[model samples]
Target: MFCLHFLVTSLPFNELKLGRRKYSERMYAERAKPLAQYTTEELYARFCFGRDNIKYIADLVRPKLQHKTKRSHVLSVEEQCLIVLRFYASGTFYQVVGDNMGVDKSTVTNVVKAVLVELASLVNEFVSFPKDDQMAHSINVQLVANADLIITNCVVKWPGSVHYAHILRESALYRKLRSNRPNGIILGDSAYPLLSWLMTRFPVANTPEQAGFNSAHCKTRCAIEHLNGVLKRRFACLNYLRVEPKVACNIILACIVLHNIATRRNVPLDDIYDGPEPDEMQPGQPPMFAPNEGQTGRVIRDAIVRHYFRLMT
Candidate 1:
């Protein structure tokens, strides 16, 4: 039986020789697999997700508990900020964000919301609209005067609740602008309610001609849209969010703060517009506004924008 076993093993040697070539080829192919290319800075720039910001964000979100469990994961304020930024920039789902950050989906949701609440307070305190008379007047003259029109894009239904739109409008930033420019004429898309209640608050122009101008004017406001796109694209987690709606709202707010900061620091704009121009005046569509009337609003808005641009420059 031993001799038979030896003969059996030895008989396979001939077949083994034929298989060797296939095995070698497969091994070579495996070895030739392409390596991922990205340095830490490159990854951060592309993903907009930075470990450095984790500590700042974590501190903002950390609960004020007296006793802490030793086994608990200690997420820093900066990390929390990064998560929020990633969510807003990429619109990545919570589950995906958690997996990327090595945390559960629920944790990511909580962290993002908590961080936003905290940061929103900070943003209100520091990054506010022009309050002082001189600043407000300058903003009105420079930025507001130069633009042919003032367009305020309102997204009515965000993730969590219907009231979110009102909350945004009531935010300190928006309030400051509204109070300072009582006579300012603003334009919005059709989705928003043209309440008579708000008509006296500001001269709102929502006619078809005005809407067309607003759409054309969007190019100037594209900065915020780009900011949103950047946050989502950088963090793959935002692509498939599964967190509670409240948490998602917070994440969005936190990202807005980061976007503002980046803007303050003069972050370069991402050129994403390649579509046909909406403002291209159609033939036979009599110019929407009399040259003088249009010029008045344009002059005011442009002046406001230009002043800000100069300061930024």
Candidate 2:
């Protein structure tokens, strides 16, 4: 009786297998309807793959939220560097970067700021003014000994502005004057009252001829402008930043660091400003001044030109 019952059940197994095959065939036929008959929206919903794939991969790699715990999110030093590099290289918005990296936008902002602070510290380490006696010695040896004079640029601002313009001016002057030679003189344009102040502190190169010379100065001072252009071009997202100004400042500094690194490695800058003619200045505008110099200023000016030439070569 047990053998007879087993045989009856086994006989239905073949029928069940056939029924499954038939069902699968029916499903395939139903799915084979002409895709062209669908509306554009329906076709896109059904067949589009690229955007979905990107989102899917991003989702798959996204970090899971942790419950309140003792452990913190741990990012390694190299990973931090990569984050900074990608920010500078691609100029993607923070939200987009966060989406791609599977993190929050705030996390991306924090990573960039941290990277800038660290890099600024490193730049200060490698490039800095020499101290008291050594600074004096270097000034005498490098500037006074070889050059006719030194020209310095200065800018005036409210007492507590965070801009580095004033600090750079002071630092450059200190570095220049530390050498006890009298031959080097500092130069400044009209905007800097501190130029006169510096002249009183030490023998500086400011003269009536040097006043209002930035238009002329553009020939040589174009490097900084070019640097800024290179920065904005490479990272187009900088133009449309939606973050707070302080965060934007940090992002800008990080880009500067990356620019220096690329420059040191001899990477050529892309010229994004190569276009048709620029707009003409309107009537009544101040005439653009060219760098004009008397005998005293010329000697120092030539020295600067030569110095930069050597650096570039």
Candidate 3:
């Protein structure tokens, strides 16, 4: 053993290439400088937020993301925020994102998880629903937005195969609506069962009044559709989340929080290509939970047709 150790030590460091090699220092590339140099437009294009906005986000998440590690290569709060944002904006592989940021894929994965957990914790503070995943694998995101395209409420828990109406029926909002009822009618498409507080389109608009009601309902309800479009546009990663179902759910919620922030701040969307949200359900399908359709909903629909849509048409 002594002779073997002596021989091993006698070999020059340059010639000891075959066995377990020791690195003198842990190598850490300068990760933040390149991103720091990006212009506002360039930053927006890549991170989906300008320098100022990114800084603001860094400040917001710093409390949760800031670690007390003594390691010299530890990521700063700002750098950590950028890494996750880049992942969300690009929706590319972790290795791809890490390469752009001068970090390893493992680092990218860690930072993404930490940041998503932090942001997703803020869902209640930012999002307001009128109330309150996975296989080959996808989750249905149910969103409610106002005219300004700001998402007021969102549900991001159901599996991809779950029926839309089933999702609604199972929501806290549904129970609240059932118990207290909405002050104003909420418009939903044909897939949703007609409820007293939630109006779905008529099956056959035989009369001019019913046709006009359908037209008005469609125009107004399109706000939610536009919200979905802008959301996926701003965070293209959400278009096709590559993570497992649970992690993917957190990513979706995190994106929703960021989406609201961007929308409220009026961050420009021109940098990202905008498109319509793809509709998964076929049109003209029978309404879900038809047996459970509320009688009061039919009365309200007829009243709206007689009182409002009749005058407009």
Candidate 4:
């Protein structure tokens, strides 16, 4: 009885504050608002993206964000999305993100990679290149996505200087596209092998006619080029690519997801880039015998060239 009384009396826990300090909680990651505080514009500025985008990302990953303990909530879906976006937009260190997020560096790392994996699974949902009669124009709408936002089936994760053409050759999406549109054309640069359905540029513009074709081709494919530029410029991480290829690929896709959101909302990434840069990532002519345009491709190219020539004249 004496020992029990002594233990009870010695415990001064009741006099002390119960939980973690409020200042400490909020100094790092506890700054998350109740989603009622910021207007749409303010949210965009703070998160460096859009409200709809957060929801979209939330829908994709929220289900997967199970608690490690399953007894309490450590990080909300909205917080995870915000943390991921902050990392993408700032391109800063994980420790820095953790400080901003009020969590440990390990938490930041896990959150980013978890969100990235979820986003990567959604690549098919947001990225695509539709074919003729593929419901692109049909009411079905899933057949092909809009040309301006096409993701070209899947993204390539570089593993020590492997060529993209090899990836393209191995892609199930490319094969499916080829089979679906045997006579149709897809735009690509020298890094990709040419097929009858794939349009690449002339290596040289020795003649006026060749120059005209290349120019028209460039103009036609400029949307994709501008997209690449916009994505790189907005996220700022793609400019140098410091992360592993897997993470890098997911980051690129996530940025694209937000870019499409920004486009749909007509909300620019601030007063900065109105559109893509003038000097785009031009498509090139792949090396010979690796796979290239055939006679059918030439006919289609000739027709497009003639049409443009007529417009010029």
Q: TM-scores of all models?
A: 0.45, 0.42, 0.83, 0.71
The TM-score between candidate 1 and the true structure equals 0.45
Of candidates 4 and 2, the better by TM-score: 4
Q: Model 4's lDDT to the true fold?
A: 0.60
lDDT of 4 by residue, 151-199 (tens): 4454455453444555555567666756565334566654454455666
**C-alpha lDDT (0 to 100) for residue 172 of candidate 4:** 73
Worst 10-residue stretch by lDDT in candidate 2? 140-149
Measured by lDDT, the strongest candidate is 3
Candidate 2, residue 256: Cα displacement in angstroms equals: 2.5
RMSD of each: 15.7, 18.7, 8.2, 8.9
Models sorted by TM-score, best on top:
3, 4, 1, 2
Which residue pairs collide, candidate 2?
Answer: 136-178, 136-179, 152-187, 186-204, 186-205, 216-291
Candidate 4 residue runs with Cα over 4 Å from true position: 1-30, 34-37, 66-73, 134-147, 190-194, 206-209, 258-267, 270-295, 307-313
Worst 10 residues of 4 by lDDT: 1-10
Ranking by lDDT: 3, 4, 1, 2
Scored against the true structure, residue 203 in model 4 reaches a CA lDDT of: 68
Model 1, residue 154: C-alpha shift (Å): 9.1
> Per-residue CA lDDT of candidate 3, range 47-163, in tens?
999888888888888888888898776788888989899999998998888888888878888899999999998888777754321111011137766666666667888897777
Model 3 misplaced regions, further than 4 Å: 1-23, 130-141, 271-293, 311-313
- For model 2, residues 1-313, the per-residue Cα lDDT tens digits are 0000111223356778787432222111111121324453442233221233323322322333212355333444433444455565566776665554445566677777766665544443333334434322111111111011111122222233332323433545544543343343332322222221122111232543343232334332334344445556755656676666666655554444444444444444446654322212223422222233133345555454444333322
Angstrom error of the Cα, residue 26, model 2: value is 40
